[model samples]
Target: MKALALVAALLLGTAAAGRPPEIALTFDDLPSHGPLPPGETRLSVIDGLVAALKAAHVQHVWGFVNGRGLAREAGTAGVLEKWRAASFPLGNHGWNHSDLDKVGAPSFLDEIDFNTPILTGQMAGQDWHWFRFPYLHEGSDPAQRRAVRDGLATRGYRIAGVTMSFGDFMWNDAYARCAASGNDAAIRQLEQTYLTAATEAARASRHAAQGAMGRDIPYILLMHVGAFDARMLPRLLAQYRREGFRFVTLEQAARDPFYAADVDPRLGAAPTLEARLKDAGGKPLEIPSYSEMLGAICR
Candidate 1:
């Protein structure tokens, strides 16, 4: 089966066959994300993830926390402590994962401000000054986007940008459902769907970079700290390795030219580099959305 999988990957011609690509892994919804299976504890989820990171030698992965999520999830502070204990850097994902579009600029900025103290308390002496916009929505308009950008600057925060994501969170939720139902066939299907999606997203982003900048810039992949991720991270990382991805810290990935885009408060927020590229007239990339992917399985 392993040999068959490899053959399938090669035939698809999407495997990383040459120079290794560089990518940084960043997880949002930290402390906890979604309900765990019947018996899984938050500690086990966090510890398992940290262990995977250690085994992968990923020294600088980033995890963003929603202050409210930390408060809502029982014993999440302990889970966050584990991240700090493992030396991972934490950033603010807002007090709640509020969308800037619906919350309005003023409310959204408040959310950003609201998360600081909790995050600061959790991450002493470590640089916890980065902010990832919840839902990757900066604002609905240029003015609103600039408003948040200015607010972040005033608070001494750099926006953590995501360039590649396979919607792992979507796969995770589906996996949890299948696991609960004891559907092994669905579980197997989910794994294959996930790996295939990851490969395709990587390839599309690489091309998007090429079309936009004439080269492949270091990518920052968005994932979540959830039960399925803990179980699958090793395999996911292995697939990335097979495709020639060298894991780098968020700091290192930021050094890539693509991340150097000046945060122009005058411009509206375009979260992913691909979006920015498309806005600048690059070819449209047909990346799948989580809702779109989930519909295929759920239906």
Candidate 2:
């Protein structure tokens, strides 16, 4: 998909149905530092992100580690330490950021296994049960989903699911350009674009509530701990807070029954945490892709 189109698609998917103090922030690629310090690139995004969370007094964050980078990157260890000390949750993103669905269950699970030790070693006391599927895309298959889950279970990892995400990666990038342009119009345009998406997403959930599900549960806001988020987070959080929404972690939100019970019979993804309720021969309708079955959002 084209970049703008792709960005819009991401915004719509996570916004499908929700409202309120329910939100979770997650970063993909830990230590998203650039080449290294003294080098201009120097994981600027990560540094910004960490500072934003610290200032916000955020207690729990899901850091998706890039195993290889952990060993090579200079500041990666330091970043991990700060997170560990603060007791934020750490998740495995794979030995590298390999796409789980594309890799097939075998290699996919292996990447996860290889990465776990490094993540555990860095994280120490906390549990590394959750995982964020790279690209937020996993192959749409039931068996593969099961394999991924079993692999995690074997190594004490759980598949993490996100219910809400802002295309913050894109949002931040766009804003960054506007700032550089030094144009007043660009700044207004940037804010207008994102604010509209955020509002629409919340509205979508509320509309779904009056029509279908009585209420939308906690919304998991996915963001990368890169150049964009660190700067965007404080503003995003403040914006949401004013909008009357609070923050949450993936663990807290996934624990909700509706989100857990969403089973796509085709690609099981992972078994629903609400297994008992899921049993007794009634599964929610296997709807088509949220993108396909439904028409283009933000079109």
TM-score of 1: 0.88
RMSD of each: 3.3, 8.2
Candidate 2, residues 142-184: lDDT per residue as tens digits? 6776776666556655556765553545555454544554555
**Tens-digit per-residue lDDT, 14-105, candidate 1:** 33555567899999998788668657888898998999999988887889988887677667788888998998889989887998888878
Residue 15 shift from truth in candidate 2, angstroms: 16
**Candidate 2 stretches greater than 4 Å from native:** 1-20, 33-44, 71-75, 172-188, 205-212, 261-267, 270-299
Task: Provide the lowest-lDDT 10-residue window in model 2.
Answer: 290-299
On lDDT, the leading prediction is 1
Give candidate 1 regions above 4 Å deviation.
1-19, 262-272, 275-299
Collision pairs in model 1: 16-243
Worst 10 residues of 1 by lDDT: 261-270
TM-scores of the models, in the order given: 0.88, 0.70
